[model samples]
Target: MLLVCVFGGLGTMVRYIFDVSIRRWWHHAFPLATLLVNVIASFCAGMAAAGYVYHTVDQATSLMFVAGFLGGMSTFSAAVSEMVSLARNRRWWLAFSYALMSMVVPLVCAAAGWGLVAVTR
Candidate 1:
């Protein structure tokens, strides 16, 4: 429990820093920070799953990564809010594109993470 809390705090701080960094680079109506964080979190979560499957790491470590770290990093609520904001602003096409890509890219990245583990093993 202590480890999870510590890791979660670390993850949250990292997420904040990363989001701020990216926001500085790209100023737009889209939610680039949330998308980037989610993609990274999904990939890390996939890696954590693979770690458990391949026994590269113990269950506790996997849980810490998935439930603590990635849990803190990813923001599903923020994604939904951004989509709503875009829709409210009448950016239907951008909202649709964001929604579609947000769904697809994370899956691809996660699959890639799993494939990486399999291939390496």
Candidate 2:
């Protein structure tokens, strides 16, 4: 629990830094920050899941990485908020596109990450 909390805090900070930097450079209302965070976090989650399932990750490590870091790094709330903002602003196409990419890409990345564990192991 302590490990999870500590790592979660670290992960959240990383997410904030990463998202802020990207938002600064991109300067768009497309939710790129949330999208990137979700995708990367999903990959990490997948890998951590696989590691735990395969006994490569012990309980503390699993709690820290899976329950802590990835949980902090991913932002489902922010993603939905972005979608809502886009729709409210009448950017239907952009909203739809963001929504689609946000779903599809993360799934793909997660699968890839899980498959990566399978392959490497």
Candidate 3:
């Protein structure tokens, strides 16, 4: 429990660091910071999953990566919040694209990750 909490806090801090850095760099024209953070987190999550399945890491380590780090890093609420903000601002197309991409791309990425692992293993 304590480990989870500590790792979770670390993950969130990493996320906030990226969020602030990207927002400063890009100035929030869209939710670029959020998207970039999520994507990088997802990729890291994929690598962690792959690492776990290949037995490069044990179950506990896997949980630390997936449940602790990725869980804290890749935020569903942030994506939803951005979408809601878009809708509330009446940017229908942008909102719809964001929503759709959010659903489609991550699934595709996960599948791709799993497939690559399967093929190699």
Candidate 4:
């Protein structure tokens, strides 16, 4: 819907802000920008999903936050970039850890949301 589009735009803007801000502050070897964005967005997504399931949010708000903001904020491209960087550096273990951790954390967050909704309501 229109609301989702608007929020999606906002989310993209927010992601850019976070990306740029972090890159400015911490321009080191590691990819702190992408890691920070993905983790925070995942948390937000979990909270939004819980809120919607528990009826703490209406449909429009759910669409905006869950489907739009979280979608825009989480960056698969960044993850791929990080993996590429690791491969280029020949840090295969670190690259594998990065990939594994990314998958584990998001799944855990989603499960946490689902469990919270089931228990609370």
Candidate 5:
């Protein structure tokens, strides 16, 4: 539990840093930072899942990674907020695109990450 808390805190800090760093150069109304972070978290989660399945990662560590680190890293609420903001501002197309990408991209990234790890064995 302590380990998970530590990892979760670390994950939140990493997410904040990543968001700030990306926003420095992003200069767009779109929530690119959140999207990228979630995608990354999903990919890492897939890798961790595969690692656990293959007995390369122990249960506690896997729990720490999935429930602690990845949980803190990904931001579904932020994504939805961004979508709502876009829609409120009448950027229908952009909002729709963002919504679709938010759903599909992370899944694909996770699958790709899983396949990469699975193939290594």
Candidate 6:
């Protein structure tokens, strides 16, 4: 539990840094930071899942990575918040597109990550 907390803190910090760094360059209205972070987290999650399946990672480690690190790193709520903001601002098309991409892109990224790991073995 303590380790998990520590990992979570670390993940949160990393997420913040990534968000700030990306926002520095991404001055657009879209929430690219959150999306990219979520995508990367999803990909890492897929890798961790595949690692567990291949016995390269144990159950506890998998839990730490998925539930602790990635859990902190991914910001689902922020994504939703951004979507809502977009809608409220009358960018319904962009909001809808963001919502759709937020779901679909991560799934595809996870699958790609999983496939990469599976093929390497």
lDDT tens per residue, model 2, 34-53: 89989999998888888888
- Ranking of models by TM-score: 6, 5, 1, 2, 3, 4
Off by over 4 Å in 6: none
RMSD of 5: 0.8
Tell me how far the alpha carbon of residue 32 in candidate 6 is from the true structure, in angstroms, after superposition: 0.5
Q: Count the backbone clashes (under 3 Å) in each candidate.
A: 0, 0, 0, 0, 0, 0
Least well predicted 10-residue stretch by lDDT in candidate 5: 3-12
Worst 10 residues of 3 by lDDT: 27-36
lDDT of 2: 0.90
Q: After superposition, how far is residue 74 of candidate 2 from its true place, in Å?
A: 0.9
Say what the RMSD of model 2 is: 1.0
List runs of model 5 lying over 4 Å from the truth: none
**lDDT for model 1, on a 0 to 1 scale?**
0.89
On the 0 to 100 scale, the lDDT of residue 40 in model 6 is 100
Q: Kindly provide the TM-score of model 4 when superposed on the true structure, using C-alpha atoms.
A: 0.81
State which candidate, 1 or 5, has the greater TM-score.
5
Model 1: colliding residue pairs: none
The digit string of per-residue lDDT tens for model 5 on 28-94 reads 8888999999999999998999999999999999999898988888899999999999999999998
Q: Write the per-residue lDDT of candidate 3 for residues 84-115, one digit (tens) a residue.
A: 99999999988998888787777777667666
- Candidate lDDT scores, in order, read 0.89, 0.90, 0.79, 0.80, 0.93, 0.93
Prediction 4 global C-alpha lDDT:
0.80
lDDT of 2 at 65: 88
TM-score of each: 0.95, 0.94, 0.86, 0.81, 0.97, 0.97
